[model samples]
Target: MKFAALMRSAALVTAVALIPATTATMAQVDGRAGPEFAKLFAVFQRVKASYVEPVEDDVLIRGAIDGMLAALDPHSAYLDGGDLQRLETMIDGNYSGLGLSVVMEDGAVKVVSPFRGSPADNAGIKAGDFITHLDGTLIYGGSLDDAVAQMRGPSGTSIRLTIFRPGRDEPLEVEVTRGVIELEPVTHELGAGNIGVITVNEFSADVGADVFSAWQDIRKEAAGRVNGLVLDLRNNPGGSLDESVALADLFLTEGRIVSQRGRARGETILYDAETHYRGDMAEGVPVIVLINAGSASASEIVAGALQDHRRALVMGERSFGKGSVQSLLPLGPDAALKLTTARYFTPSGKSVQEGGIKPDIAVPQISDPDFALRQKYQTRESDLRGHLINEIGIKDEEMESDSIADPRFQLTADELKDQGVEDFQLHYAMETLRRTTASTVALRPAKR
Candidate 1:
């Protein structure tokens, strides 16, 4: 039987396909790789018979299989049961690192997305850029975990990265200082004009309910009617799929919310509005979903659904474009396979693999004084090596959320600064709602 089939259940899909099945392979030694397997077995026997010290069969076997899977993709890896528990603990609370979401692809370490304000983000490391070397050492064929381990060190120290961005013909070098990554899953506040700003830092557990409570708090804090809402998913590396669906359902009353398609029949599933909630929580209030290159997975799921259903006006830059679903399939009681089982699509059937969800209004963040500095180092999914083909065949330039000159955005960082605007993206979205009536944002039939 196939190794993946050994899993008892495939449940709890995550942003990165983290399946914990047996790291062992079940394929028969009868294909073109048959000769290769024979060589591996022979090497194993030789090592066992004449090694410097005794090496256990399971140790050698696990190493061989791990090496095999490591070559597959960035997200695919073999985690022992202990590693699995450690991962769970990390996800549940704390960790230390340079605060980057990285993956291995095509033998190169790739940055998925640096946490907002992370050392990597501050250093201008964009998504979709290839990290070929670390500290001048070539890491093209290194393990993702090892690379991450090397990147994680005493906070406040710096590391140098040699990056190859697609748009640029030449490679660029960046130096980033490492810092601890503390994930604050959700935070909210009621801004002026009774507009509620909910910043979903990560898609961890209970986020849907948390956002719902945030909305209730926003209404209570408001002196009058809530005018608008801003779902700030910027720099949010997506988490729970169920939370994404539930969050989208907060504003969507009807229609298909999102769907997943996969090779296995079971992986193909449809999620609809009201699957988790009864009615639109913020029925008439204008919702602006803010996304950027860091927004991915569950973040894309929420943005795509609301944009497709016309339930919200997605603003800010394009998302991280991680549309694939990773299911945690249990191999035994302790281990599981976090495998990429399906590609998620918007209600309109648009795949967000390389082509992330484009906002209704493309708003660039020029508010920060260092906006230009940040633009120098940007990355996205399309720039990733071995990134799933969009099939939509989107041009690479479209994926570049880097600042392109637009005359409409004449406001310099100084201008925005003078206006007491700290966040350009959220400020612009709020100003738009203040000027435009909510009726303008109401659901309408697509032009097509």
Candidate 2:
């Protein structure tokens, strides 16, 4: 037997032994039958007995598993053996492949964003480009799973992609070599006279520790006279629930950080900053947070917490709005299930679902003159509404309970242009920090 077949057989044997034959039989005899269970069993038996082509039991079972999970929500998914391995690498923030984040759109796999400095980005793969073919094989209308499998491979292996740009009539082909992509969580630099600028790419595991260590290093370099802080969360697709909470605790003194609400079985989890994990920095020190469309999930948690507590001024376009909590459930063996168990709420108890976190200062990105037309035609949430799965059944009370009453600051359009900052959001943050700190310092009593 082939290795794949043997693995599948072993998986089935293990699954059967764990379930107990009585459980399967009892499913049929139970008083309250699950709608999904009945439908799945009926489909399985029909496919096994009536399909013209030889139907493998394993394939049918896996399909059922996928369907059941997909029905729950877009984020909740069943990771097969291979998928589980890839997920493990992703959570570690390192993977060997053409680094790209993709989503299925209009029967084509579209590049949502390419990781900075990755093979795809280096090869000029821009966000909003549709990938139609992989190595001359038409990939459109196919499963995203198959496309991801084809795109990922060993380091140094070259793969050709046929891309469809928005304005171009002809398809463009680009060949890229895969490599191991290691993401840097935090990068810092001294900006504008002793002001500390820290850009966080993502909130992964150990990100809080990394940020704290970086802050310590920056303070030592500045000799304890740091003027301001700019926390950049632009393009930071977030990670780790605990990391977000911990990071917020570093700055906040007294406020609820975030809240999670789920089914009756799972109690709400709340993180507050009043406990004081990290000592206060400069008193009334000006801090600004930068966010954009790519800032999501845990990133939103940090931004929302700081903003709600009046700790920092937030600037940028609205965030990507992925306020949901997912639990990684091990399925034994190498497989696993990433299931969405709950939705996240800001300190004020707002649900950032379809409606994302709106920035206090909105600074939209001005596209380059060459790509202006393409930018005008780009897709937004309205275009992909069909794919969104609203499973949590949230109500207005839950969403509005934590809304921000008043914003501390706002930025004008000309101010953004004058900064000449592509991430004008970050620039606004830096400038806000500078102004606030100067004001605070001016108010301090002179040394006697």
Error of 1 at 391 (Å): 3.0
Q: Give the TM-score of candidate 1.
A: 0.76
What is candidate 2's lDDT per residue for 1-448, written digit by digit as tens?
2333323222211011111123444346555657767877998899899999989999898887776776765566676665544444555556778988787665789887787789998998977789999999999898887898899889999999999988777989999999998767788877775778777776655778888888888788888788887788877767677778878888876668899876635436777775545644444556767876677778888988877776776777677767677665445455556666677798877877655677776655542332445545554332344334335555434533544533432344455456565544455566666666554422231122
Off by over 4 Å in 1: 1-36, 39-63, 81-86, 94-182, 368-377, 397-404, 442-448
Error of 1 at 291 (Å): 0.7
Which ten-residue region of model 2 has the weakest summed lDDT? 11-20
- Residues 366-411 of candidate 1 have per-residue lDDT tens digits of 8855455456666666665456677778886765556567786779
Q: What is the TM-score of each candidate against the true structure?
A: 0.76, 0.77
The candidate that achieves the highest TM-score relative to the unseen native structure: 2
Q: Give candidate 2 misplaced runs (Cα > 4 Å).
A: 1-30, 34-39, 93-95, 103-107, 143-145, 153-157, 165-171, 281-283, 367-423, 432-448
Best by lDDT: 1
Clashes of each: 17, 2
Question: How many residue pairs clash in model 1?
Answer: 17
